[model samples]
Target chain A: MSQTVELKVDLGERSYPIYIGENLIGDTGAYLNKHGFKTGSPILIVTDETIAPYYLDTVVNSLRSAGYTVVTHIVPAGEQTKSLSMLEAIVTTALTGNLDRNSAVIALGGGVIGDLAGFVAATYMRGIRFIQIPTTILAHDSSVGGKVAVNHKLAKNIIGAFHQPDYVLYDVTTLRTLSPREVRSGLAEMVKHGLIWDEAFVDWLEESASKLLNLDLDALKYGIHQGCRIKSVVVAEDERENDLRAILNLGHTIGHALEAVAGYGELLHGEAIAIGMVGASLLAQKLGYSSDIYTRTKALLQKFELPVSLPKHYDVDAIMEAMSHDKKFKEGKMVFVIPTAIGKVEINRNVPAEWVRETVEQLKGEA
Target chain B: MSQTVELKVDLGERSYPIYIGENLIGDTGAYLNKHGFKTGSPILIVTDETIAPYYLDTVVNSLRSAGYTVVTHIVPAGEQTKSLSMLEAIVTTALTGNLDRNSAVIALGGGVIGDLAGFVAATYMRGIRFIQIPTTILAHDSSVGGKVAVNHKLAKNIIGAFHQPDYVLYDVTTLRTLSPREVRSGLAEMVKHGLIWDEAFVDWLEESASKLLNLDLDALKYGIHQGCRIKSVVVAEDERENDLRAILNLGHTIGHALEAVAGYGELLHGEAIAIGMVGASLLAQKLGYSSDIYTRTKALLQKFELPVSLPKHYDVDAIMEAMSHDKKFKEGKMVFVIPTAIGKVEINRNVPAEWVRETVEQLKGEA
Candidate 1:
């Protein structure tokens, strides 16, 4: 708490701050009060089963001590929890809890919980305030953008809204409990922030990869702070993802397809995006869009120990079909955020389908 | 089309027009294209079985003729149609039909259809464009306000969003197909538009009640246009119901409770609202907030042949319990939109529970 790093996502009245700190969750009540969460208003804390055993009691006690009525809805942990059925179940819990318009919902987990709870806040009573407590590094990307959603069976994040949070409270101490795979998974998105926007940050992440992996609090804090800052800048400018924000989906094109093709269970989201980023770099190089983009992007992702190739078991045609179903897919064109440099990308709207198909094959390490 | 009357809901960039006329559904394609719905974009038409048999083909043919791809999802016609299950099912259709971010959804029915489809559009891809092809007279009120939602089992419209439509196409010809009860149910809202904001409109409605009941096209169009114009003005002033727009809920607090108590089958929305309005006026008189509000309101509702009294079978405690679950309920306070005059209301944040209970009993015509 003594060395908190804060960034603001400015969207006029909907603007909010993101606090990256240590042990902030213990002071959740104070933060909620300082951020204008109405006194005595009810709150719903939505977390995953995995996180509940660790932090739910602390959050509930903090909120209760603040004289606010608190309710908890714990969901099963995983990507599958981000579904319409879960949304309905949580909404029912909200109703039974008597959450009113003045009430707030706190998302107390990773990307999946943040998105699900944010959407509940977004649609409950036509919109209520919500706060994000991102426990995973991957949420450093999802939490800042206000892009809350659930995945349909056919597509990932196909049903969602751009409902900004009141603010985001990131307590890095929660990261200590994550499995090695989860830590690597979150690092992929942290790396993505640099890949899409800041060359120097990407260079720093590469240098500090081992320190971050070993959970050096200082390095982890600095890395998460930098990642969040980049994401907030992009979100503040393009909250709705109209034009400029599309750049944030740099690797999502093939990344989402890979996830869908693998049934969303084989790879974590950040891992999928890491592969997608590698694939995009390959395509960029093939099209002469950049110099050494494939080698450089792959190297950074590899440093983070993230996957850089699609599993050989994935079918190319299935991946293509999945890409076609993506929310970003428009008018029968393969829309890719192609990197022109280490930290610069261009929206390529008409990438040849065959090029993408070949890139899929290449990603299988066959080429 | 020549007699079409147009008015705009001034919401800046989200602003849209309301067209009141005859046979607008047959020209929905032209309207969609004219309103910037892309020429080649796919569209999903969401309507109930009742309206589907009547005008779905016309909408489908109209869009197809204009070189726009079209898909349709039809649900059973009733208040029950607005639910999370149905929302998910329609989202599935949108996905399977390949409706993209560029595509649009057309809601072709009454308030139920408008709200359901608008929510689908609002959430599909975080929101795509949608048009309101309102086929029932009751929609004159619901279609104008950007309040789109589905009901949870415990409350009416508890889960929803304020996603405005691209435009609303109100074709009076469709009103001819409505049964007598349905016509009266719609007129209840039309009369309410007057009760909440315009004294002269109330007077005019009183004089033209017979014509509106007969489905006289000219009277219907004029009534709808005025109703929409008044609603649009309120919505523009308070798009999110934070302040002035709350006046629009004059009877909805009690009305929504009735709908929930009655299982959404015993009363059409407008009918429930009509009884609720009478009760509101009665409470206002008792509170000394207004003069002659009760008699005049009951007279106007009776002129439209809408129910002014709650049925005798309803449990008072049950209705009271249901009201507590309303999105509008707060801090154990009974929030009611109380009439101050024949054409104006104010948000009453704290009405006595005992008085509300008495008023509910009085509304049963037992006093």
Candidate 2:
């Protein structure tokens, strides 16, 4: 039996736990039962085509062995799958499968599957219980926050709700099969977790960058655990980004803009955020925060092979227009999560457009 | 100023108030501001084309005069608009208009607009604030409960969530413009509220049936006020329809099936529910609850000119098939809100399919 690290997210009645371990998907029945998922109730496992063949059977068989009826919905892989058309299809599938309020939806892949399935659960039959079985490292950040949505043509995640899952089953074993780019994409958010909230976590992540990249079991477990822990605390305090929770958007403002301008799926979410974080840091420095902190952050990102500058030939105007479409924009003003120092950030809603343009131009030159 | 009756639906953090009156739409600035809506925040007013021509400007101007920036999204009139495609369009419009987390969505039409717009608010940016400005009498029932949804091809309102509004602004003045069939349709739910909760209210409604149909201001105000008050109490006790709230579905089990079988819009929601309520009473009597209750309930429905029997040409098998798609079906068992007596009902999860079939056959003869 592999060692499992369990942590609880305190969200009053909506609270659930996160279990991080190797090969946990093979025996998820115990965790399912502990979370009040009763035997005989139908469970719909929502996974992508890419992930379905890998671990879907293990989860289905485990639940079936426990006397629960399980159904599977295989969505196409990629960001395009997170659209209203896909949402309608998933809802139709759930309804056709006869899932009721007692029935549960299991999101069994990475952030895209978790988000698409989670939104289905949030609105199907006006809400039902759902569990998250995240397969990628980036999901460690997304699965915990309970912010599930489908993307719109105008903006990404523009249509969604805050529906917390019953529990998150994180099997670190799945990370071993990821491509290097996928691993790097996931590491950007893990790096972000340390950059925004904990100085010690940042120092530890920097020290273990090599081992972490190599998929060291201990390093993998600690990275996901710490990322989820920070997210859980922030979500607990501010379930709906009313105040402090916006800190979690440390790099997402410009990150989402980059994804939109470059066309979604052209850049993996974390890759875009990796560049956005560097832009934000530079913006912070330009705003008279700290140049020293920006240099340190840039160095760490480089060590992990994450992008720290905008892509060459990308239009700054298009990115700025995309940022204006972000939900964070209030009454025509752009809001950015700027770091003043390592392990600390501020939501600067009054950042001028000229400063963003300058940073994008400078970052383009650097790239 | 016309008299206004204010009632609160208590669900702790999700609690909101319902204001019933005439001409409230003309001066909604005070209500919007009172409900925590700040000046200068963008507001999306979602209304159907039918209602938009009548009441959209009143609302848009009212909010604008109060220092708020308002945008409008007009959906086509009818039940078909309660769909995922329409939800996507409205969300795209909100995004295009740059509505944010702090911005609010105001549903300014009847039940369809309220449900569609409410679901949009429920999921937009993971839940933003929305106000309900119900323009139809049918909305008196749909608005008070936090049940918002879009219809699935498999079933009506199968895709939705329990997203409460900041406040429900019910202007009875809008009801005066409704057609005779629309007035009758709205009255059915009001009558159901009485039948399920208060015997005295039922008697009062029976006495005021003529005035209600004629659109008397006093009767309209009282009917909506009492109906909302009952719904508010039930929702407060069971926000998610776990146990107690299921009782509010009095006639909906078979009612929804009747609508689905007949094809949506071929039968108005209240018309279908009115027939379902009578059928439910008959089922209760057949199960040895009380035959006298069925007779008395039939008299009240007939007095309001509401349908009390299934259509002559409807198929029993098709109705049963539709019932199977209902959300109340639990683990292969169909659940019905059976009336034991006036002002009393029970959520009977064990009702046999044979009883439903037999009642449908019998009701067809009566029709």
Candidate 3:
């Protein structure tokens, strides 16, 4: 049986909806029209080489069947694709395709495609419209938040923007193709949603772990809906990360640093974040913010086969240096999202650098 | 004796003041601090080769003297400096200088530097703060509207964003170094301000032409202030160019096409716009929208020693083709800002393309 779930991100005029369903890719044109995208203006579909073979044609054909003038830009699949060079390439394609101010760019892959295409939409002639079509589990989080960016050679997401999409079309049917490693990596963010603000979600996600891993459609739909609902609420309150939005960066501070130090190819984004969340819990325990947060977080991640410890070879100094380059780093202070309980976090702006150094060292010895 | 005039652009929180005065470059640090820019976070001063010899050091030394950390990025002075390659280079300088979210970028040259550096500030970490230090007469128009962009190989301002600056510091003293051609070129936009929204200013500009040409401080200050005030009002109502802001593009439609067809190097931006305004008036008269606009506009531009007609050598077909690629081009119709009267214009989306081709042809024979 096919089913669909919908949630809205309430941002006044910038607000948009997130649609989670089975086989939604084939109906993208209808969704776009429902959201007021004009068929007379052109649409650019930005996807990756890996995903193009499966879903690109379907999306293009659907849009074309519905009378949209469509252009496709296929980029190589990887984190490296999120570069300024790639952005310029996409912009060239957009220009060649004659995409005007009324045009919209559709991101038809996972987080990388979403970020890259969203950014292209954000800056092309001072921003047009953007749509996100998530083909990976990780995108459930990236697609909804409107935090689009491309990596800088010196740091991650160093050049980017807060461009909200018209809506996100999350077809979980596409997630069936993800490799086992990709699946595990994607679940890290799902667990993050639970850890940040919803204790009940964490408990439910734990109970439904096997069902989610098995690709049970009902479980997947419910889990994604909850994750997006939580995210949309947080984003609605802090669209620009002015204040409450920092909570969403709970594990990203350490996760982004780890990704930067590891050259972006060593670990999947979610795997890095899984380890970062555990490290945060350990730091929480060290600070007496929580007594058993470290143990509980480690166990939950272990069940999902997510990495909860850093490798011994990665340098602590490199990790620290990368964190300082982060957008969250302020005035030489080490800012961190510290877990206080199973479903609560606090942004600590003055976390001692030496303490973080000790926590990075401790992560390697754990498990 | 030196004089100063301050004007505010009212976009609520995005609102900032424009300061028109003599020797403001030497006081750049005080103004930045007054605007609430932090002294602790590093600042990137982006300038160009032509202006670097005169004002860069004064600006840098003052900032340093005020206990500020400053990094300088200087590029070749030309329209070409507003390219993605140049933007990437400046981003590298910003990264190497360790500019974080709290940091601000100071555009210390003319329109080219302001557009390029403002774009860097717009996207670097998804937009930080930006300050415009306009060094040319033309920047009075470009610096106020928050329309920052870089050109593409195929078109002008094909990539851009509406990121307003924290404030504008216009030091008329810098205008003294401009060559006669440069001075006249800069005044085209000053004339545009009068033609679009203030007829009294046009009569005043015609009367004070020699004073402005001679770099008389009082005349220059008043002219720049009026230009900025009119632009700020238009932008405040439609910050994103949705409706009323199209008035700012009065001459830009043909002006951009002329610049694009001329390969960007042959004609100064304001000179191209001066000729475009003449073409616009010619088109208005052809459309029966106005009668004396053509003669009056051509005479005023001639009085300022600005170009009032397109060069005969340039291909008319090429200009028409370039117009189709412009940001202002929509659908198959010719969208132009047509002057219905000396102090007003209307956005006509259904202007015949053949009529525009005819107007472009007519511009070559005028005067």
Candidate 4:
């Protein structure tokens, strides 16, 4: 048995644990028991086509061995699949499968599947219990915080709810199957965790970059463990993004706009966010909130081979239009989570649109 | 100004006040301020075409006078509009209106709008604040409990969440515009509240049956007040329907089946529930859980001119199939909220299909 680290997201009645370890999926029964999931309850395992072939059977077999009835729902893999149609299909499958409120939905893939399945569980029969079984490194961030949604043509994650999961069962062994780009994309968020909340962790990640990129078991475990710990604390303090939780969107304001401009799936979520982090830092430095941090963040992102500037094809006008539609905008003003220092950020809703345009222009020139 | 009754549905932080009175819609600004809704926040008012012509401007003007940016989204009226497509349209409208996380969605119509708009609010930007503005007597019941959803071809309310609203602003004056059939439909749920929770309230309802059906303001106010009080207590004690809340569904098991068979608009929701109450009472009588209460219940329903028998067109096999698909089923056994007395009920999950079939056959004979 590989070492396990258990962290509880303290949400009072909705609080649940995040269990991170290597090869935890092999001992699924033990984790289910430890978390007090009743054996033999019907389970719906929701995954994407890309993820099902590798680990679906392993999970189904374990649950079946424990006398639980398991049903598998396979959605086509990709960001484009996250829509209202997919949500309806999943709900239809759950109803057709005769799954009831007592039955649990297991999100057994990456962020897309976790989001789709989590929303299904959140609304099926006015909400049912669901557990997250993350399969990719990117999921280390998405799997926690209970913010699940599908994208709209106008906005990503515009239609969703804040539904916490029963527990998150993350097995780092699954990260072995990730492609190199996937590995790098996942690291962006882990680095974000460091930049927004922990300077020491950022330095540690800088030193351990190669091990993390190479998927060393201990390095991967530690990265995900620290990322989830930071996220759990933030979510516990502000489950709804009413205050402290908004800081978690450090790179997201610009990142989400870039993704929308790139037409989703063209740019991986973490890749867009990586550029977003750089844009936010540049704006922060220009605003005199910080000096040198923008260069420092750019260097860190470069070390991980993540994009440190906006893509040349994305014009400032298009990016600004997309950002204007972001849900974070308040009272007709765009809200940007700006990094003021290493491990410190501020939600500045008063950022002038011209400043953002100018920063994007400069970033484009550098690119 | 008509007499007002203020009741609170307490779910800790999720608790909200239900303001019941006549002409309350005219004082919309006062209510919004009382609820701490900041002026100048964007508001999306979701109403149906039928309601928009009647009261939309009044509400929009009130908020606009207070410097709030109000956007009105008018859906077509009726049961057929309660669909995933309609939900998609509403969400799209909210997105197009540039409504953000700080925005509020006001459900400004009857039960269908409440469920649809509430689901939109419940999921829009991962749940935003929403207030229920119920315009029909039937909405008095649907608006309070925060059970919001749209219909699927396979099931009604199959896709939804238990998202409590910030407040329920029910102006009984709106009920004055309802047709007699609409009045009858709304009364069914109120009668169910009396049948399942309070025997004295049932007696009072029976005495005031004519007044309620004729839309007497005081009778309508008292009936809705008592119904909400009962529902509030039940929801407070069991918000998720783990046990006690199931009793609130006394007539809904077979009632939902009848509505499904009747094809949504063929029979109004309350008419179906009225028939469902009779079906359940007959089943209760067959199971020896009650004596003449079934007869007493049928007489009371008839007094309000509510349907007391399943449609003659419905067959036992078809209704059974529909009930089997209900979300209430657990482990292949059907759950029924069977009334054992005028003001008492039990969640009987072990009811034999044979007993239900016989009762439906008898109900058809009576029809």
Candidate 5:
């Protein structure tokens, strides 16, 4: 059974939906077929090794049942594999699959597949329609947004485009396949969303930390819904994160640095995000914006077994050096997403390196 | 005297204008200063080697005057530089330059620079703001649409994202420094817009081809404006190119395959398009679209010294192979954009490999 979640991105005609439920990918072909998708047109299923083994069969079976010509391309999983090589292989796969301009691409798995596959759709034949069937919880953030990209060796999400999926079917039932670590990782963005825009939501998250950690289905649904809602609203107001969107990066400044410092795959994005949130909280304390929330935030994250400190082997100086290259650094000053208070954050474009250094040092000791 | 052209992307609020003028690199300081741009901000000027000698200094000096901390990363000149390696180099340069999120990147050359630089912006730190100061006629097309990306060694424009610039400044005076071949190169897109969307504009170009060749300022302005207007309409209707945007690739299917077949940098982008239009026209005729128009197109391209025939040494099968790897090929079939008539076009996704090969052979042998 599939449940549909309607999201209006507010971009007039560019607006789309998020169809959430179980057995959705199987029905995706039928849905499109009903929507006038031509018969015998090839359906390209793009996935990463990580998720293909788990869901690729189910999805392909669904397509087969729908009377569509289906083909699949599986690439090595991990951020490192998101490259021109993968793109070319997928294009080759898409070509051999006999896809045409009107043929659909189904992106399976999480952000990596969504991005890699979306990019292929954006450029293939100039542009092709793609559907996102995200498997990871973290994809709640990536999937709702049309920002599809691959990581260049030096930068994450470097090679990409804003190619919106014709439809995004987030089968929540897929969450059963995710490890707790993945769930924890997805929480980071949720927490960041709360810190940046919704204090009440942050309070709700803090109050419901245990339920979330337990993967309470209802709480999980609420979490995904709220996360998508917040993201959808921001996207509606600022479809492209040109201005107001910067607010969404409350914990990303330090989060990205921690990811880079620890290496791409070492730290689960949520663990780094946990540290980033802590770092953000410390920045808030330093700037006198309610240091108390830092403790509460860390406590809740710690409850979830997410990292509350820097990775022990990571070097602070190296992290700060990585910080310098962050997208948030403005005018050569590392901008901190310091909380003004719970549910309130400001882009602290003025936090000195000394503050980052001191906070990083303390976090290292904590680690 | 930098001339300014407004790129009306139609997103409202997120909407900003692109300034195309003479000495934009010099006048750019005031704009940066007025925008509250601070000092010591890392400024990555993404440029190709060809335009570096003629213009990099001016861009650097202008930003420096605005108190921006600045740096330059140069890629080999020409279309081929829009590659994964180039993307990595830009990221590495930014990492080495210590650019922060607050930093800005100035794309200081033509289409290649704008696309690569914008991709750098989209990915570096997960995105940094970039401004475009396009120096070639080709940029009128590349700069306006939010499409930023690079080509794979095996595919053309295969890896990329839709990263729009904060502003784009097109200095027609920049054309003063461009080679005549470069100027002619941009005419291809202008001609493309005319064929796909603006029939009167195509008629205008047909009559003004001589003046355009002579670099008449009025002719240049009209060409740029007309080309952009068609793009503006299309992008506005489909910012993500989901539907109407495909029309913009009027001759690019064959054009891109040619570029990839001959090697990425072998043919200037516009020159390939000139040939592609000739080839697409023949494809159009074979499908009973327009023989007279195809003949006229071949003659016009011949007059401009653009290659109407396929490259002398490249095999037709090899070209077809390259086309097969084209990102547009889906489900084991090739999709071709052929004109219905001189001023009209239709996309045929059902085209077979045999037809593409036969057409290539026929065109390769044509006078």
Candidate 6:
């Protein structure tokens, strides 16, 4: 028997159901049919060069067996590949392929392909339904969240729209191919869900970190399902991150800065987030929130073999400046997510900026 | 005393309040204060070479006296200025200007500046709050709508986000300097609002077309207020345009095609939309909606001196291809906004592609 995860993204009727399971890839045909996904339509599959040969054939074969006309667009792999040049190249091919509004794009690969293809779906004749078949572990968080965007050289996820996929097929099988680092990066989010919203989930991570590290299938399924659930509910409540959804940034504030300061792809997102979660925890403890929760969060992160501190040589001022540019800061104060309790997170902006500076200095001394 | 027209966009908490009055420009400071727009924060004013030279200092003076720190960025002006290169340049400046996430951008110009600056605010630090202080008739519609995006050569508004302004100040006095052509483009949206969801507003446009053309402040305010109301209602319901908001594309389907096919900036947006609206109305009539509605909509458009048909020289295939690439067509078939009834709309993908071809042929014949 398969289990269904309910994501309550709060876009009213725009809300959708996300089904996670082992053989979702083989069964997507029915989900497609059930959701009014046009049958026998010419479908353009936008994927990365790295992910296509491995998975495109499966999706294409499934789509073909289901009686659909499939046209595949294979883009070069890498985050750098998500550019105007790439978008135009695919759009030109899509245009040449007689692709129109009725044609759907299956974004194969991780976040980049999802965003690039989703943008293509969004602006191509206004919008189209695209299904996300995320292949990377890092995508476990990004793929389901309705925040589809591509990066500019100056910023990440800079140009995008709030485009929800018609459906998301987690296909835990895809994670089997992820590198060890990818698995670790994705684990940060599972831990993030625990620290920010779910206590039991946190304890679950603390116990199952070994199973996840070993790529245990059931553990992977539980982690992904629960992480998606946390995000889905927040998204269901605040699809645009205007309110409670912003809490999902439990570790993303400093996590993104670490990635940016370290130069993107330098620090694994999950690794940075693991460190960020510690920083947020320490900040929470600094502001006198919960010392026990902070210590436990760090201990759990350590158990996963994730780094909970920055490299010794990284510039503190640059990190601080990068954080100042973080999207969470509002009204001239840097907003930090601090745990009020294990299951409760509060968006804290009133905490003195000097304390953040002090933490940076303290961390520098410890380094 | 001046009357204020309110645009109640239903984006839950992220929704902003729009104030349309005779002197919204002067009231910018007071309104921002009243609406919880943080005081003593860094403000970046985005303007263009054209409008900035005229009123930038005045806006700056107002903010400075209100005890706010204001920084100004001036771009060359016009639709051509709304590009990726320009966005990069401004971001560099914003970063150098030491813009933190707490800072706000005040977009102080027409649609181009509003879209460009709004996108900057949307992208900067993953997103930031920016206020809209529009200086053109066209901006009355755009400034009120939360559809902030930038143009890529592949698609107009291809890259963007649905980030609303903290507040919108639509100063009617600013419209006096706009070219007759600019004012005409602004009316396309007012016309779209009536065609999509506002039957009484359609009657109002019919009754007050001359007043709009004559630059009657009362009629213009009425038009903007009603347009904002319709847009706000749709946006509030579907901020990301997953459903009800798609109705806003009544004429834009063909209008965007006309703009792209004719070459952007060749035909003003409103002019293309006017022609597109004519084509859409004609298509709607042919699809068995109502010939009476078509005549009435066309006559009302004609009264505004909006272009009623496309030029004979434009190839139908070119426009069709442009529409194919329209950010509206979802999968493969072109979706049309056929009148379920005047002021009521149902997105009709059931309309054949043949109807689009036939309509274009008829339009060419009329030309």
What value does the interface RMSD of model 1 take?
A: 0.9
Q: Which ten residues in a row have the lowest lDDT in candidate 3 chain B?
A: B324-333
5 or 6: which has the higher TM-score? 6
Worst 10 residues of 2 chain A by lDDT: A325-334
Residue A162, model 1: lDDT of 85
lDDT of 3 by residue, A119-139 (tens): 999999899999999988888
DockQ of every candidate: 0.76, 0.78, 0.74, 0.79, 0.25, 0.19
Report the TM-score for the A-chain of model 4.
Answer: 0.95
Question: Could you give the CAPRI-style class of model 1?
Answer: medium
Per candidate, chain B TM-score?
0.94, 0.95, 0.94, 0.95, 0.87, 0.94
Q: B292-336 in candidate 1: lDDT tens per residue?
A: 888889888888888888889999999999887564455656788
TM-score of chain A in every predicted structure: 0.94, 0.95, 0.94, 0.95, 0.93, 0.93
What is the DockQ score, from 0 to 1, of model 3?
0.74
What is candidate 5's local distance difference test score?
Answer: 0.76
Per-model TM-score, in order, reads 0.94, 0.93, 0.95, 0.93, 0.73, 0.76
Give the C-alpha interface root-mean-square deviation per candidate: 0.9, 1.0, 1.0, 0.9, 3.8, 3.9
Off by over 4 Å in 1: A263-265, A289-291, A309-333, A357-367, B260-266, B289-291, B310-333, B364-367
DockQ of 4: 0.79
The sequence of per-residue lDDT tens digits that candidate 3 reaches over residues B100-193 is 7899999988888889999999999899999999888888888988988888776667678889999899989899989888899889889998
Model 4 spans with C-alpha error above 4 angstroms: A263-267, A287-292, A310-314, A327-335, A349-355, A364-367, B263-266, B284-292, B310-313, B327-334, B349-352, B364-367
Candidate 2, position B225, lDDT: 91
| Superposition error at A341 for model 1 (Å) | 2.1
Residue-by-residue lDDT tens digits, candidate 2, A91-189: 778777778778999999999998899999888888898899999999999988789999888777878888999888899998887999899899999
Interface RMSD of 4: 0.9
- Evaluate candidate 3 and give its CAPRI docking class based on DockQ: medium
- Residues B60-151 of candidate 6 have per-residue lDDT tens digits of 88887777777888999877787767877787677667676678889999888999999888767556888999888777678765767666
